[model samples]
Target: MINTRKKLITYLRKRDGIKPSLQATLVNIRCKLPDVVIFGGMVRDFGLGVRHFSSDIDMVTTASAEQIRHALAGLNPVMNKFGGFRFRENGRLFDIWSLQDTWAIREGHAQAKYLSDLCRTTFFNLDAVIFDVHALKVRARHGYDEDLQRRVLDINLEANPNPRQMAIRAVRMAIQKDLQLAPALVEYVLEQLYGTSLNLTYQSYVRQLHDHTGRTPESAFRFEPQLKIW
Candidate 1:
């Protein structure tokens, strides 16, 4: 297995592709926001790869439904006008979705309790970070902290999806980010949750998605890369 720490460093190198300092700074300033966290793909990167990058990152903060709506009031002059937080600049999109801690916690824990084939995630795009205003600390939620409490909190939070659904979404995103190139991880998750392989149709769709989203032609064509044959 790849040393998780090494993979994390690699991801950091690639994540430099897009400068997120502005967003990071904004999040830092908005630390007072309740249960505020920088989650999604960026955060997922820490658990999965050493170097990764993504244009979009999702931020989840602990605020009342109303408070979240108010905090993200000014996403973009027009985006706000359109009643959404999706903004596109230079052909890339950024999204900010805030959820109350109650909602987030209702869904699941923020850290992984154990690294089983089911709960363990070994692929990501862009390292994810959490700026906890309450704690007054910015932590690498997915990196090689080597400490259980620090590294595994809860699985990524989702509004209306279960672990299986989230795993599929994560696999797709990882392919898009070029962080993982095999089906093993996906199968691992499926087995853990579903106790079987993905149905033919689902498998085909995943393959197609990977073909279009993965790093290279070969990587997409061959789910099992030479380096990570399983």
Candidate 2:
């Protein structure tokens, strides 16, 4: 784990290299909040060396909303409905929030009381990872390291409110990372594959997302699964 953690830092530095703006923003947050840490997908990307450039990142701090607003006043952070503050740096979104207001914890899907607890609230195994920006350390739960190593997607939580988005993101990650879907994940995606009040098929929506994001490699578009109709 120690070696893997070191490798994550190494990858972030060498591959897609961290941007100066992001570095400065993190430093500023640490200086003000002290308890802030970067968590979720960014950590997963760094650990697996999957990037061509740095972009948006999610961070969590134990500070109160007023404190966070005051601390980030220079950035003019805009509060999202979920209580997260968003500000742009070099055109990249910085999603910082109080640890106490994480959607999973606030919605009673998970419980957390510290920075590390943030790792337990992700929707996918690969995303259940956190990076301690100040200490340069990594922590994770829900088979994050194992699944990331094997390049598989598995469910970390199944009771979330956005299964449709979850299913779409699962497909996108499988394409972007060349991952195989765990049975549980596959079942969930199959169940939520179609959107409500729309005639779009799963493949169509995925294609649209692929085109819009332009992040998934063209070669990875090989997911043509056969369904077993009941």
Candidate 3:
């Protein structure tokens, strides 16, 4: 596994646009909410050494939504149904989720336990990897770092797995990270797409395809580079 502290610092240093603002924001949040940790796409892309212009950052904290809102009062955060707060600063979006109010607890999949347990229950693939700002350490479930190094796409099937969402995200990540899906994983995603009746509309898929490829929806779906099953 990579040294989480060094890699995180390096990642932040590389982002000249948001580094100073992000550092200041993190310091302020940590001062008030000592248990908040950064995670999700930012850390994932950092680990993979992929550079992309991202406007949002995701974090989880032990503090309540109200506490977080109060702590970040200057930003004027708005609370959402998912028990998270969204705010913008310097043209960047910050999404902070209360650890006590995650969907896993509401859905009865897991209890509100340790940060490690919460990290394990996160989304499938490399997105589950988390960076604890306080400890300056990385928390990843089994095979997470290996998947990152290998550029393989696999889902955490045991923890409230949403195949449809995973399938879409997998395609996006594959394109973003220049990754290839494992044979079995590709087969599984295809099965999930063909077998289940997902609420995701055809128009959504068309939009996503168009976003990824500049071609018309018909041509995009027919020959999208990201969906090439390896």
Candidate 4:
């Protein structure tokens, strides 16, 4: 578990290194995809004040499945430097789940099923948002998720970056051993992930959180560091 925790932190630090550029690239993709919705860790991290590069960029869109399929088709070859790419589209419901190693794609619905499904597929973390080309509004959706809100609040105290709360959320999720109860351990996980050197006040809060959660520090940060490209 300690080894897992260390690997997770290193992965996050690297992912944080790539977020801004990747975000801009996706925003550019929005010009082509239109009605694309992106939501995930990237969104959560930006909210928390952690300025770092992110690798896995997840997104949700209002467009139909066909539209999503088409957009992903375009992303191929062009985004090769970052890594490889793969995608899944459900035309019946107009949804998509795309992946490129550490990153993932979740579109169509915002329900627990889609979110949980995408969450289970990755190793590091994810960041997503929705872009409405028609309306020209690149909306931030994390403010609406209770779990995400709590995670962002906890991480932002130390790692919040400009408009990158989504990224922090992904990191928080990575620290969470159980998705269903993620909100319950946001404080403890963030402390274990970031330490008091980053935010002194948050130290006591993490201890209190451990008492409330009844989970050992090892449990809070136990994620196997596996980044499978497919």
User: Which candidate leads in lDDT?
Assistant: 2
TM-score between candidate 2 and the true structure: 0.78
Quick one: how many clashes does candidate 4 have?
58
Of 2 and 4, the candidate ahead on lDDT is: 2
Candidate 3 lDDT over residue span 68-173, tens digit each: 8889998899986566888887667888988877767657776766666665566556677777878778887778877777777665544454667767666566
Report the Cα lDDT for residue 96, model 4.
30
TM-score of each: 0.42, 0.78, 0.75, 0.36
Steric clashes per prediction: 22, 0, 0, 58
**Residue 79 deviation, candidate 3, in Å?**
1.3
Task: Name model 4 segments beyond 4 Å from true.
Answer: 1-24, 77-210, 213-230
Best by TM-score: 2
TM-score of 4: 0.36
Model 2 agreement with the true structure over 1-230: per-residue lDDT tens digits: 46557765665454224446355657778999968888787777766675443667888988987889999998889998777999986567889988888888888888888888877788888888888878888888846667777777778777777788888788777766667676666656656763444333456544443443344432223344332111
> What are the lDDT figures for the candidates, one per model?
0.41, 0.71, 0.66, 0.37
C-alpha lDDT (0 to 100) for residue 159 of candidate 1: 37
Worst 10 residues of 1 by lDDT: 113-122
Better of 1 and 4 by TM-score: 1
